[model samples]
Target: MTDEPQRAGRRTRLYALTDGRTAAPHTVLTMDTTITAAVDAHDGLPSEWRAVLAMCPAPNGRAVAEIAARMRMRLTPMALLLGELADRGLIHHRPPLEGAETTNVHLLMRIRDNLARI
Candidate 1:
């Protein structure tokens, strides 16, 4: 069997390629005498996703399937939601794993982990 630490390193790298989306941005409505927010704003993301998103330590990006699994749905549904967000300028959909920033974050996480073990 491979070393546990090395296997963990590979697992970390695998997950690195999955992150690509950003967190949903919250728009600030005017703080007037009366402020009305959507049910979602007060309620937060659908229960399923709220927990899953919370579990994401890095708090950015997701593989299509990752979101779907959280919602207990299929990839098609997640794709639709992501598309809708992008269309509404609420979120951006990245091309697969093209973002350099995600890679940097992933690398940083790996370094942090390795350092912690030393």
Candidate 2:
């Protein structure tokens, strides 16, 4: 009555998907980083990479955490894949806003309340 088997399988799959790379190279992406597709075509790419590209269209973008959730992937592996795509000019991202830690909590609460009322 444990999920260990499933967890192991998922871990193995992620390892393969990332080609055993534990970290992204030359790129620093945070959970809130906004990702967007930079290329129109995804021919000859791996299915996971294609999935990532498909999830990210142009203009409006998705947050790294959102993409990881939608794709059922861990943040680190997703970031690694995204970093590779960015290196190849297949995608681009905007890091989380600087100084977000100092943002006004009251304003955020108001926004949350407004959203709840909608």
Candidate 3:
């Protein structure tokens, strides 16, 4: 009942945000890809875009999955928004390191151990 309207509205908003595009032009982005705000001034940009930029500060960036979770947005659409921003030079993206799964296993193990301590 009430859920119907909310879902419809969310669909409408997502369509508007991505301009009805189901896929991003550049498909290199992955869940672990890092995103950073390239420009400090986002004046005149849409609220959604501004929000995404606000989440990603320079230097230490946020992972694609983290941003999507934080914004309550689906990964595909978030990737679309990020692709548009990157096209406009408003943001920068770095794909995950090659062989991250194999290379970062040690790091992941350490983090897991630390979490178990808490």
Highest-TM-score candidate: 3
Please list all clashing residue pairs in model 1, or write none if there are none: 21-61
Residue-level lDDT tens digits of model 1 in 1-118:
2111111222222112224433323332111111111122113344332333332323244445545544455565455444434444444334443357457887669646744543
Against the hidden reference, what TM-scores do the models get? 0.36, 0.66, 0.69
* Cα lDDT of model 2 by residue, 12-89, tens digit: 366575667666677888888989988764567666677777767888677787777776778887788788778777
Sort by lDDT, top down from the best:
3, 2, 1
User: Candidate 3's residue-wise lDDT over 12-110, tens digit each?
Assistant: 366676677666666468888889999874668777677777768889777787777767778987888887778778899997767756478787786
Model 2 clashing residue pairs (backbone): none
lDDT of 2: 0.71
Q: Model 1 lDDT vs. the true structure?
A: 0.37
How many residue pairs of model 1 clash at the backbone?
A: 1
Off by over 4 Å in 2: 1-20, 98-118
* True-structure RMSD, every candidate: 15.2, 7.4, 7.0
State each model's CA lDDT, in order: 0.37, 0.71, 0.72
